[model samples]
Target: MEKIISHAISERVEFVLIAGDIYDKEDQSIKAQVQFYKEMKRLEEARIDVFLIHGNHDFLEQERDRLELPKNVHTFSSDVSCVPWQSPTGTKIHFYGFSYDKRHIRENRLGDYRKHGDADFHIALLHGSEETKASEHDVYAPFGLKEMKQKGFDYWALGHIHKREILSSQPGIYYPGNIQGRSKKETGAKGGTIVELSEMGATFSFFETAPVMWEKKQIVLEGKADRTEIYRATDELFQTYRDTLCSYVIDLEIVTEQASKFDADEWLQLFEEMRTESPFVWINTLRFIEKNQAVSDKWYQGQFLADELDASLAELMEDETFF
Candidate 1:
């Protein structure tokens, strides 16, 4: 976060926009608040403004302010609100946002946003996941992508979806994702979005901010591929890119057919060897995948039970080491 703020300061960005979910918990400790403010104060000193909306997990209580913020930090109200900011270059930007008052918001808050300013660029800061007709997900501000697209906002900066995704490009709708990944489930490139606005509109791109990366790499070999080849390839690939990744736990699953020479002991040994050489590489799982190719075979069509037994024994026989 300090590095990110320093980067913004060096770039002399007009303003910083945080859609929501500043903290993992709403009852953030004083130390955490101090650390967060310490970074924000730097931007405040640099004459750069910041706009933030508190997400469901980071809502303010009815109690008096829990943390004090600098003059430059402007947070949106619990109700939908808009703030018009005039850039140093005399460009007007209308920013619409709202902080979550509760942990779960079932209502579609998009209707609450009333576009009021004649600013050159109009943008919305939303913190919710897109809802589908058949989706079983918790309805947090239930809304559809199509409705959001037709809302007339020039750009939509979204949050709540921890994985970065761009729903649209023309009138940009983006989820910057969480800056830091907390778990293995949240893997891959974790970072924030950088939006550059002009007469053409907002051009958005994602930049890596997490010091450590969380990634899942799946490695599958062909039916006739050598076991040694798999070990060598996995070793070389990790060794080649290990330095670039701060830390990673790769979940590896192997898929093979009758031609495969399988060895659980050998694979486990290789995993150990890699960990000894590169401690950052943690192999989570080694799975054997069974494809439906056997069931589709003409020879196995009418003999389901017989074919199942043969296929299972074939796989076992291929892995047998004892005489």
Candidate 2:
């Protein structure tokens, strides 16, 4: 947030838009609210406008006590509405969005968003997932891609998905993604998009704001390679990140046909030893995968004892007398 505020001030952006999920939890702590307020206050002092909405994670609760935001901040209400703002260069812009009133919003609200007014640019903010049964994410305000494209908004600033993606380029539908990664699974350069819009179309670039990044790298070894060779490759991998400015929490996956030769305890000790060498890199996890097999025979014997016991139990049950 500090980086974002600094960037906004430095770039002299007319306004800032936070799609949703400002708070991690619905019942946000006072400390978080105070911290956020301080950041918002900084933007307010710089005379930058902030427009934000609530997502499922931080859905609005009318009964709950809420901290009053700064004067510069404009929050969207439960009902879909369009707020107009004149850009620094005198380009009329209309921002259309709505805040989540409850945790679950099963209804598709995309139809509610319609480009209106004589504004030069129309930007819509939506915190929802693409309507698909295969999606692992919770379906809230589900929308179809075709439905969104047909809306004819100049740009769609989306939220809810932690991974940054440009669903469409022509109309500039984007998911800036979460600025900070909360888990190891959410990897890559985590940040928001700086969109440059015009009467022609929209062009945007992603900026890295995450102080610490989560990354996963896989090291593939030949069947003939020994432990010494494997360790050397791992060391080489860490050396590549020596010039990284921000700290990284990396998960390493070692793939080899000679999985039996690799020892977890030795790798764990090696990780601990190398962790102190670089202040910027911390190896959070180490996993081994067999070359062509799903699970290595040695992995089951050494790591997954529960699976082995289950197999043993199944064998005993074949005797008929073994309950």
Candidate 3:
């Protein structure tokens, strides 16, 4: 949420639209709720209006009724509503949205929604999955891009999915994915989408403001095994970040079959010393494994034992306290 707000500030966006699922749960702690309100207040102070809707996680209930929000924050209830605002670029925009009353809404909510007729630009904010065989998401509240386009919406801002995607080419249908990745599975660059509207048409831009960045790097440790090769691989990985001035939560996976006298403990110690030299770089997860092929009949029990020792060392390198 902070990243979204910061990006909006930097880009000087007219207003921010949160389709749904603002909070992970309705019963979140008071501290979290308060902090959320504070950020909303900050956006409100900046004259930025926020249009929000309730998703499965943050379903509207009596508990949410008690909490107060800033005037700039407009939340849709059971009834569909349209809020009109003028952008700094002098484009008149109309935002139409509604929240799901229940966790599983089978019906197509967009069908009941009234269109903003004759508006310069009309945006429909919804939190549901598009009907597609390839989609692994629930069929609940299903709607299609063609259906949305036929309904006369200029742009459809969708949520509920954690991966950013542009669904339609003509009418400009988009899913902003998620504000931040909650786990490693939702790794890589996760962020929101920015929309620009005008009398001619609408254009879309992606803004990545995720607080925690996730990056996966594969380091090949093949051929002659030596300390120099390991050091060189680390340097290469670090050099990849020269273009993007951003700190990364990196998961380094080293694939090799070569074995040397240096044990896992020694390798970890060297990495720790290198980390001390450059505290800014972080190695969240490290996986080192030996690449093996088919076992030949000529391989004896002694060779098997040696291979087992190499695997053990690789596993030990994963532990931070191995040194």
Per-candidate TM equals 0.78, 0.85, 0.76
When sorted by TM-score, best at the front, the candidate numbers are: 2, 1, 3
In terms of TM-score, how similar is model 1 to the real structure?
0.78
What's the distance in Å from true for residue 106, model 3? Answer: 3.4
Give one digit per residue, the lDDT tens place, for model 3 in 212-271: 677777776767557788778887777666556455666776666664344656565665
The residue-by-residue lDDT of candidate 1 on 1-323, one tens digit each, is: 88678878887888888888888876788888899999889999999999999887787678846778998999998888889889899989899988888877877888987778598888888888787553444456767888887888888888887878888876888888888877766788777667886656667766777865666665556655676767776787577665664656666665556433576566767786767443367676666553344335445556658777775554344211121
Ranked candidates (lDDT, high to low): 2, 1, 3
lDDT of 2 at 22: 96
Measured by TM-score, the strongest candidate is: 2
Whose lDDT is higher: candidate 1's or candidate 2's?
2
Give the number of the best model, judged by lDDT: 2
Which window of 10 residues has the lowest lDDT sum in candidate 2?
314-323
Alpha-carbon lDDT, every model: 0.75, 0.83, 0.71
Candidate 3: clashing pairs of residues: none
Q: Candidate 2 overall Cα lDDT vs. reference?
A: 0.83
